[model samples]
Target: MTQPSRRSSQADPAPSPAKLARVRTVAQDAMRGARWWTLLDLERILRADTEFWRDLWAPSLAIAAHKVGLRNARSRLDEAIDAGFHQTDLFEPELSAAFGADPDWQRVIERARANVPVPALRLTAWPEPGPAAPLRLDRAEAHRVPQLLPRLPRPGEGAWETAKTLLGWTAGLWRHANARINAGDALDVLEQVANGARYSCVEYSIVLAQGLNALRVPARRVWLRRGDYHDGIGQGHAVAEAWIDDLDQWVLLDGQHGAYWADEHGKPLSLPELQARGHPARPVHVGARELMKDPALWAAYFAHASVSGIAWEPKGFVPVFQDGQVLATERLVRDSADAYPRLSDLAIGVTAIGGAPAVELKPVHPYAVAGSWNGETITVQGRQRFARVLDREPGEHRAALAAVTPYGPLASRELRWTAS
Candidate 1:
């Protein structure tokens, strides 16, 4: 491996008019997009490439602007730091220098420094045996899927877009009412809904999950409750999540309200992500319909979002709970850092050139995954959990892994590293 050379910013001359405009344009877009990393990188670029050290510190400038009471200058920097920003970023020297002087900025930094990072697998040893069987659930009957095909979007429509369309359709099925019917599954709910039956949030989740499963998109019902659930707080919300093959992550869908929460970049969020309290999710509705237009109102619902469990059926294996509830609480979590796995949990490592130059893939969670490393395909499922090694050259390499989900194969999670 070779090291790239570096140039000193002090030796660079002043920027021309064109370069100034380019820098400003980048700064403007970074702020408008609410992508915190881009704004940070812009600060580094300005400090490294030209004499304008703090000129492009857009977020920092906004924070300072807020303190000065500038007209229409409400700094979302604090909110950005509170949500979506990582603790690893709190230590950036440029960031420290930019906001270190202000006492108010220092408090925000301190709070963000305490934020939890997204959980990823860090294997200390090779994977052991998983459950005797993968968690299987009752899928929408194939014969009944044809009934839903005509109502869905085109076959090749994007995963996220298709999901949103289905959410809209399911939500508009019937008016929400707190009535319990002796329905067996989502299909039963749908049939009853057509005959003038109004159901609760539970039915909304079931129908959405079934709808997605019918379309070959991996989906499951999730129950959210407060910590005082057992004490009869009577606060809970049922929603469904679908594994988007393009994003490689599960996104929450609320058919009850015809709503889903997304970040500023329009990326749909999972229940766990919303529980992380990192990013302020914006409420989005399907089609031209408007719902939950207020951010505060949306955040209030998810503020106490404690997941009770996932809704799935175990084929050969008997679950602790018979109500088809697979606990997502502390009972199921191995790591205290995160409540649950947001994406497919995987452990990947590479051997040195002297050690035969290979990459080892380990799928940790019980969910089945199909992966490819350096032109090799690997599949892990059920008790068949074992490290699969792929031969690769002693250079930069990349791998793509996706869960062979209940809905189908989701988007692949990409991994890249240099093998020396």
Candidate 2:
């Protein structure tokens, strides 16, 4: 294979007057729709916050015309992330917290410097469902993914908040179902839920993914193995990861604990990447964070990690997200194959020759679909691969794709189409 010559992320060319107007429009709409647009604490933070420029950032003022998004409207405030302003923790403003003896909350900046960084994926399309391929919406019996977004019980902005909202909304519902029995279709499980039946990790994962789909965010269930007999978390662990368009990366989220994984650098990570970081105290230090106000759920994450399972997906066979939820927490994949196969690098990557997208997915499954879009409109949809169009679409054609296994939709990846 030839070596990739292009940089992961490059300096963005100056936007034309028209494009600049579009940026202004995007910034405007974001402000109009933002939930954290105004708050008593935010007013104080922005006024006193020198984090960004002289401006309050734009979150409440404009994202603080900087954080990522608005989450939980009340005493329940998750850090509202202002995307463009502080794309990474590296750009975080000054922290007044006492250092050393006191927690240097500001250390987030130093840690970011020590971590290996990847280029933010470029996007040409709007971050929504049309750009990303549709999951098993047909399986929902009565409601499709879009149809349920308004009703999914989560209107929060942070990826972390959205995940827990789904889990809590379904509290006391999922009992247990055999993995293989319905390993492929999460929509069906969703369909059955109306009848007041129980669900498993698969159902939870499916709903989580579909809910993301409803919000127009690219998402999929990520599967992990608890290999090495860690804690016997069964065969593996499964969780949903959502692609945050502004950040240009996928954020791993678990509905059960309302948790997410983060590197020492403060960048959100996918489950595969998260599991890859566990080294028993090596060069890399990985950790998980919870959405709850209380820190109780944090320790549970490590205990949950002790379960026995594969660190990654097994060779030749791609595990579905449904079974992962149970295995990741319980430490065992239900009815897992007796022999543990070697781990495969199933990380998704794209291969572009000219200025076009060539998306390739690993552990290929039959029911899954991959697609690309020019903005929000569909440009091409593929059953197997990108045997479709030119990543050469005019302007920006964002890269997005998805697949629904017999069990449910696997995780989806969203990236910018840099080829054009």
Candidate 3:
């Protein structure tokens, strides 16, 4: 993908908020969170071409809702039709049947999901994950990934193939990069490791997701933060999860462990459900331990799920944002295990880093950054000093970043910076 022509080196001076406000029109557009059909994005589409919106927009939403099994979706479509808002030519038959023609709603939804391209434009990264992550699966990779598919079983028969594939992904063709995460495009990092270079767990999670998406399988990276308490494992880790639309849920598939969570029925478990499980202390596979470079030799991590921090549908390595908060559709984030308070200073923004204004983390995450957030998202990790340009205005603005750390809630120091 072409990097936006707008360029900024690590050494460039942090543009003042005044200058940034002038460019907000551009930066904010690029920073939009996933494929969310926000007002601004809608305006862009409407301005780009109305017929595009008129023909594709409502129909796409209907298709998307049906795909995700969103409740009352077909009803909404029928409502649209009743109001003459939706053209009949644009109405999908399966969708129409789901509401009226077909008596079996479940069957209708399944059929719609099976036949349609995943309708991601209206979905968010969480609650219902979308397809537009920055780390992309382009046409080339999508076509190239099928060769790797058979190595893991198709996600059936209790996901045996899913287990093998997850293990294979974590164990195969990847070297752990000892450096900081590149922090932007998942594809860019995968390119580095395509010929067998090193990447972090975050990168591995993304690559696995990309491969699945290339095959037209829906998936997203799962952020697994080691809560304040642990078996002495690392602070955070990432893994990939696949969307079983038929099941209407996401299930964990950890490449690093060649493992996944399952219910008593031995079915795959979604991140939220897994977090809510009564997981006890468990053992981490030796290979998994090696991959993570954890200190506890017997693999204390596997014994039980870390409950303190489970930001289901969290943002990607290159974070996404809308409004002034992180990109999660669910505002209330809690891991059933840890009852400690959550932190509000959990975000970082494109502020000055060490007296230099830079979006990409230099000498750390080594990739050009794209995407914007007002202030709602995880701050750049790694032990770096960074700040965010405040809301463009003429007065003082209070900034807050919230995150859940192992020790408890993490709060950024109360910062009141004047915006003038």
Each prediction's TM-score against the native?
0.47, 0.33, 0.33
Report RMSD for candidate 3. Answer: 28.0
Lowest lDDT sum, 10 consecutive residues, model 1, at: 310-319
Ranking by TM-score: 1, 2, 3
Q: How would you encode candidate 3's per-residue C-alpha lDDT over 58-161 as one tens digit per residue?
A: 44445544554555545534433433343444454644544555567555445434444332222111111122212221222544555555433354332234
**Residue-wise C-alpha lDDT for candidate 1, range 7-89, written one tens digit per residue:** 22232344667876797678668556654444444443454443333223434534433443443332435544544443436
Q: Stretches of candidate 1 above 4 Å error? A: 1-156, 226-234, 278-280, 293-298, 303-339, 342-420
Candidate with the greatest lDDT versus the true structure: 1
lDDT of each: 0.56, 0.40, 0.41
Instruction: Say which prediction, candidate 1 or candidate 2, comes out ahead on lDDT.
Output: 1
Which parts of model 2 are misplaced by more than 4 Å? 1-143, 157-164, 167-191, 228-233, 264-267, 279-420
RMSD of each: 24.9, 27.8, 28.0
Kindly give the stretch of ten consecutive residues in candidate 2 with the minimal lDDT sum.
Answer: 337-346
